[model samples]
Target: MATTGITPSQDDRSVAELVRQFSEQTSHLIRDEMRLAQAEMSRKAKHAGAGMGLFGGAGLLAFFGVGALVTCAIAALSLELEVWAAALIVAGALFLLAGVVAMLGRGQTKQASPKPERTVENVKRDVGELKERHR
Candidate 1:
């Protein structure tokens, strides 16, 4: 029988050394998992921010567009009605415009996900894998 110095039997390694190796590896694993989670969360946050920005833009555009439309209508009415009456109509139109914008913005906001669903699912999978491995 021949034994090579390059290969050591499990018994050759000290308990303390094994413990240190296990701890080091475990720490590395945890850090890697944390990095994965952070990356996933960053991606999700970007999407959420973009969605919110879209909603804001939609609201702003709708507000201004409707305001302009109302002003045009009021100007058109000014030819036949008193300026004060046209202004009152414009005010009422403004309220209706705001309601329309609110509805549109609500739809845009509804499309946004406040939760990091992918990260949550990944974390759950990691936890389940770790549990199985530990057991």
Candidate 2:
């Protein structure tokens, strides 16, 4: 029979020795699994961070694009009126749109309550039921 010195023959090992070996192997396996999970989460977080940065860059570019389009609008309006008048008209319209949006947003904000009303009510009901059960 050929014996590899790397490991003991299981058949010759006492039960207590085998149990100790099993406990060590299980602990090692759990530690390895934990390390793998940590590595995977780190990799995912890096990818998500990169994705968020790209999204921010995209939003900036889109904002610049909108500025260009607004400039084009002013240029088109200038053909029918003085350049100063065209610019003022566009600026005024933008302010008017902003005002309308702000008013709408204010109305929406007023309707939004800080409390989680439904959840609170449910919890109160649950507590009442629990008290009744105890009695």
Candidate 3:
């Protein structure tokens, strides 16, 4: 009879080696995926920070805008009313503008909250399953 030299022990060892290699490859892939997620998260955080900064600038501009409006109001009232009454009216209008801006800023901040990433969640699930299977 013709002889084939494959042994059962050798075949089992080869299978184990293949599984170990596959596990290592999967782990490396997960690491790569995690790195990508972190990069994306950092980019998003930067963008959010920039947006917040812009909002702050806008808030500052709004303050100045309120000042301009008050100045205009005072100028208008100074034509007919007493100086103190004109200043009081301008102050009231500035307060109202400040309240509206505050509300708008609050809404924008609420909208800026970070959302969960699906890729990170999937990677976590995959790692958990792999660990459970190896055990």
Best by TM-score: 2
- Reference-based lDDT, each prediction: 0.92, 0.95, 0.90
What ranking of all candidate models by TM-score puts the best one first?
Answer: 2, 3, 1
Compose the digit string of candidate 2's lDDT tens values, residues 17-123: 98999999999999999999999999999999999999999999999998998899899999999999999999999999999999999999999999999999999
lDDT of 3 by residue, 1-135 (tens): 765697766666776789999999999999999999999999999999999999999999999997787788898998899988999888897789889999999999987748566777999999999999999
Query: Which residue pairs in candidate 2 have backbone atoms (N, alpha carbon, C) closer than 3 angstroms, thus clashing?
Result: none
Which pairs in model 3 have colliding backbones? Answer: none
* Model 1, runs deviating above 4 Å: 1-8, 72-80, 92-135
Indicate the residue-level lDDT of 44 in model 2.
100
Q: Each candidate's root-mean-square deviation in Å?
A: 9.7, 6.0, 10.6
Q: Which of the predicted structures, 1 or 3, would earn the higher TM-score when compared with the native? A: 3
lDDT score for candidate 3 against the true structure: 0.90
